[model samples]
Target: MAEAAVTQARVRLADREGFLAWIFLTPTVVYVVALVAIPFGLAIAFAFSDVTAGDPSYDWVGLRNFERVFDDPVFWRSLWNTLIFTGISMFFIVVFGKVLANILVADFRGKWVVRFLVLLSWTTPVALSSVSWLWLLHSIYSPVDWVFRELGFIETNTYWLGRPNLAMASVIAVHVWRLVPLAAVIMMVGLLSIPTDLNEAAKIDGAGYWRRMFEITIPLTFPLIAVSALFGAIFTFTDMAVVYILTRGGPTNSTQVLASWSFLRGIGGGDIGQGAVIALFLFPLLLAAAVLILRAVRRVETI
Candidate 1:
């Protein structure tokens, strides 16, 4: 009888454990289905349809929307701009962020204050930051403009966002400012996680600072850097707020990116299908990048 009772208790406990596991996972499953899966499926469907605002009608267009997207000069231009913006911003973030992380990892006076101020750029709201940048870059009252004129760098006040080249430069600069903090934080974490024994061994082997970094530190910490870069790429690729607030794809649409272009098509122009197609394009590229990075990380882990 006691044996039977113990068996029954074990069964009951197993059942309860199973129930709890499901209960815990239920919210996440529901969230993914509702938010990610459903929206993604709908976007795919919309991309193949001819959907417009207030039309009360949509027809299955097969690959027509995609073909149109390929032929559209504006779409291609936006794609180019997105690549340039993401590439330039990511370069700065990785190069400078790694340096900053190395510096901050060492003990120094007032280092905490400097780190906090550096991170403030990212913690600040994007819209508010963009607005502030706009004011600072304004032609007439801009401190940058005033300083440049005072230093005789330019003979006159310049509208930085009013020209194609300068507009692109300004947008990329702002993106770097906003994104670098997060990258630095990620790098700092990676730097901290590295076992000190490796560094000590390298030092004992007469490896100099640069040699140790290149031969040991960088290779081990590379996975984290790759992950950070992938995330930054996604963020920059899908970002519309900064561009909208700063350039509005203006100065003749030279600074337009995929997200802003999609917004213009869907919301501003009322062409839902094309906009959906544009938005969908970013997903595959980012997904591919993320998958590749994760695979590399996994390989590193296995080694």
Candidate 2:
């Protein structure tokens, strides 16, 4: 009788476990289909159709929207700008992130204060931070300009966003600043995961700081760096709020990225079809980068 009861309980437990698995998975499946899959399907349909924000109606246009996008010089320019923006921002993010991560992992006084300061940029809302940056870089009554003037760095009020190059640089700087903290925290986690014994043994064997960093610390931490970079690239590639808030892709649309340009055309210009096309261009490249990064990370993990 006891054996039979034990068997019955075991069967009940198995049934409960199976039910819970489906319960946990059902919401995620529903969310992806409703939010992600449906929107993606609609965007593809819009890209091929003659859709407009003003009309909310569309007809089959075949390749017409794609042809129009290819014909526009702004599309190409935005593509180039996106590459430059994502590339440069990622470069600075990785470099500075590593430095900050090293500092974070070390034992020090007031480390929590330092960590909080570093994370402030990432924690703040992008729109609010962009506005702050805009104010700092404003032409008149700008603190940055005033400080530079006071320091004799420039004799005149430098229009940070009024010029094309300066505007692009300013946006890149802000993006990098925002990205580095997240990257730093990721790197810090990676640094912490490395076995402390190996580092100590290397030190005992007369490995200097730089030698240990280059030979031991870097190799182990490289996978984390790649992962951080992949996330940074995706965020920078898709983000529009920073550009929109800062310059609205101004100074002749010089800093316009594919994301902002898509918004400009699809919503602002009422050409939803072309905007969808512009937005979709990012999908393949981002997909490729993600796949490659994941593969590399997996390979490192397996080793």
Candidate 3:
């Protein structure tokens, strides 16, 4: 009888454990289905359809929208801009972030204060920061202009955002500034996790600081750098905030990227189908980057 009772108890305990596991997973399943799966399906449908914001009806166009996107100069230009923006911003973010992470990782005086200020740039909202940059880069009554004038850099008030070349540079500069802190924080975390013994061993073997960094620190922290870079790439690629707030894809649409172009088409130009196409172009590239990064990170972890 006692043996039978123990068997029954074990069965009940197993049942309860199974129930708890299902309960924990239920919310995640529902969330993915509702938010991601459904929206992604809708966006895909919109990409293939002739759904305009001004028109109340959508007809199945069957790849015609995509063809139109290919032919559009605006779409191509936005794609070019996005590539340039992502490339330039990623370069600065990685270089500066790695340097800053190295600095903060070392034991120093007032390190916390420096870190707090460095992080302050990223802590502020993008909209607010973009607006602030707008004012700073303005032609008249701009602080940057005033400072440059005082320094004898320029005699005239320069409208930085009004010029096409200067506007793109300004946008890229703001993006790099906004994104560097977060990248640095990510790098710092990875740096902190590295075993100190390895660094010490390298030093004892007559490896200089740069040598140690290149051979030991960088290779080990490579996964983190890739992850940080992936994040920066995605943010810079899809970012419409700085462009919208600062340039508005203006001065001949020189600063337009995929996101802003999508917004302009869907919201401003009333071409929803084309807008959806523009927005979804980044999706495949982002997914590819994410998959590659994750695989690299896993490889590092195994090593």
For candidate 1, the per-residue lDDT at 121 reads 95
Best by lDDT: 2
Ranking of candidates on TM-score, top first: 2, 1, 3
Report every candidate's CA lDDT.
0.90, 0.93, 0.91
Model 2 alpha-carbon miss at residue 174, Å:
0.2
- Candidate 2, 198: how far from true, in Å? 1.1
Q: Which regions of candidate 2 deviate over 4 angstroms? A: 1-22
In model 2, residue pairs whose N, Cα or C atoms come closer than 3 Å (at least 3 residues apart or on different chains), thus clashing, are none
What TM value does model 1 have? 0.90
lDDT, candidate 1, equals 0.90
Lowest-sum lDDT 10-residue window in model 3:
49-58
lDDT by residue for model 3 over 1-303, one digit each (tens)?
999999998888778977879889999999999998897788898998888876848799999989988999988999999888888999999999999999998898999999999999999999999999998998787999999999999999889999999999999999999999999999999899999999899889999989998998898889999989999988987789999999999789898899999999977998888888888998987787688878988888898
lDDT, model 1, position 236: 90
Clashing pairs in 3: none
Model 2: worst 10 consecutive residues (lDDT sum): 49-58
lDDT of 1 by residue, 1-303 (tens): 999999998888778977879989999999999998998898899898988997738799999989988999999999999889988988998888898889889998999999999999999999999999999999688899999889999988789999899999999999988988888899899999999999999899999999999988888899888878887888898899889998999889999999999999988998889899999988977887689879988888898
- Relative to the true structure, candidate 3 reaches a TM of 0.89
lDDT of 2: 0.93
